[model samples]
Target: ELGLPLEVAVLGVLESGYDARAMSHKGAGGVWQIMPGTAGHYKLRITDKLDERKDLVKSTRAALLFLRELSKQFNGDWDLVLAAYNGGPNYLRKMLDQHKKKTFWEVSQVPGFKSETLEFVPRFHALLHIMKNPGEYLFKIPEMEQAEVFDVVRFSENISFDLLSKYAGIPLEMMEELNPHLKENEALAQVNFYLPKKFGNLVLKKIRKYYAKLRLEKYRKKTLRVVRYRVRKNDTLLGISKKFNVPRGRIKRYNRLRSAHYLRIGQILKIPIYRSVKSRGRVAKKYRRALSRKGAYRVKTGDTLSRIALRHGTTVARLKKVNRLKSSFVKAGVLLTIPSTAKFQPYRVARGDTLTGLARMFGVSVRAIMRANKLRSRHELAAGKTLLIPDQGS
Candidate 1:
């Protein structure tokens, strides 16, 4: 609804190279290079667990909202608005007051305004010019891929990505890649995260099942009480263990801490305290059973062995050995045994399709597609070829 030009979106490309994770030394971040204060004012959450300034869509909306306010403040003087965006509003106001100029062109004569701010308006204009006359300037921008569709999953409290990946039939890495706004390796329960639209419902469905089982298990182990602890300065797992009177190894395993030194200040860690007798073998046995539920997944178009392996938390080599596959390739409609539980579907290749493109479309690796199709590098694939798609495999 803002009156800002639609082309203003391109400004993100110049500011942060269109990288949501881009951060400057002065604390500007995201595609729009929004400062911390501006991010807060625009309601982009920044916390130890999540920094929404690193979120592509949210940050862009925040930037546009900020620009709209600036436009109104500057009385529709886009030059001054752009200048204030580069410098701060205070800087432009000081320049205006010192020079007694009512407009940006007059304020440009002031001494305090930085040289970069002076040229920023012209730079934006030049960008617009170039975009409008790309062929005239002999610029041939390559085609860009369409944006990925997403479905949002909201959490009320913190959840472990490790557990979610295992039971939710999603790859941990894929979840991380889609949700780059996360400050740590895990997702904060306070915010909603996005997954591929195709897999969102599946993941949510699996999460409910996994958590239901977990709640039942917790009820059975009535002696266990879950405690949330925030790490303080110079806190170590060993020190925390001593303070809590729990084994350091148990803490590590419970928290999925890969290393003893992987502690962060202000990061929350879950500590399970036992009120009654200590239970040992049963816990480990239950965990093994939960992780080892095996099933079969049929191959589908664009289905890759590696992707299947990842979804099931197995290695590609393990999957091949289990299926007794001599070659990397498998035809669509063929059923493959999953190391873990999963489902399967089928797809047909269309014209102008590349293996790499297909991999990206389904969020798998190109090499995986190659192996599933028994194709080598530079192998030719025919259009209209049907393929089997595995659900939640690698």
Candidate 2:
């Protein structure tokens, strides 16, 4: 873990360009993801290559041998070695890694790296770490979408990767990726490459096209939003609410959280603040609506100006006016006037309704409702108290 070792330390920055096998939007081979035929021809036997993929020496030697072949086949130039290594060297039909068709290095230093290859460069070090010490690499690995297709079988050495993929009815591309160490795509020769069948093959087709296009999309990013924060140890819902000046309830609810209990170490919790649906709909949808007098709130104890403001979608100055007060102070029992957290109809709390319960029904959180009405408990949720329940994601 201290220093990426070659067999277990060096990232395939030199071999597979340091990419992970499953997750990266970059659909290229990973640190040890040698192509099936190449792996077999190189004699990198797969006899359960699972943990072996992490074996530093084994993968390193295999990668080195593969690179050597690519070097010789690709005119002794490093570019073809890289291109062949990045995509498939032979896929070009004897074309070298340096084939003028846009090598991996050229794309990186020049074409900005293919979208799938986009993650390759930066992941070199990460691959190195995982290989060196898998335990420490848990968090380092990207949150993969779970290929759900990590198994294999043994067979003869005649079935082509393409042909086996055809028989397995799996995506030829994914079938190849899954059995990287398979030689000549013939997997176990006549036995063929084993796969997860329909779903497995389906995922292969989907990911190949999906992830291949996913490369470098960040470059085309559309929005600069108040990125959501994941909760880590020692972080309180209250503490986060204060820092962002958002009411605690809003923070909890915006994240669609069930209870503070679900708040785990490293849990990704959205900030109380949100951008409008203009954002691919991944986050809560926010829309602008006309204003009304009905939506309002007041200040209370444990009430910081920020939380109150966030709860009602109003600022401190406006909050001051709605109540016709100054200094932003209201006694523990005193209520301060404020607006809705987003555009929406306002209502008073009714009996049989807990803040958490109401928030859940309305897609708002107990914290959001509590903050809107300035309730200290955030969970107590009282009756007959008017509170603004903004439209969900607003």
53 in model 1: Cα distance from truth in Å?
Answer: 0.8
Task: Give the TM-score of each candidate.
Answer: 0.54, 0.23
lDDT of 2: 0.51
| Global lDDT scores for all candidate models | 0.74, 0.51
In model 2, state the lDDT of residue 291. 12
lDDT of 2 by residue, 26-61 (tens): 322447665555556655444543423433345557
* Backbone atom clashes (below 3 Å) for every candidate: 18, 42
TM-score of model 2 vs. true structure: 0.23
Q: 1-394, model 1: which lDDT tens digit per residue?
A: 7778887876887788788788989899888999999998989988877889988778878999989998888998888888899899988887887778987777877766688888888888898888877899988777777776888878766778887877876788888887889977686775878788878778778878777678657753763444445567799998877665667987786776899998755355666656442346555343223223345666889988888878877788867765658887888866565553333445577777777666655545677666666676634678888755443354
Off by over 4 Å in 1: 141-148, 223-394
Which candidate achieves the best TM-score against the true structure?
1
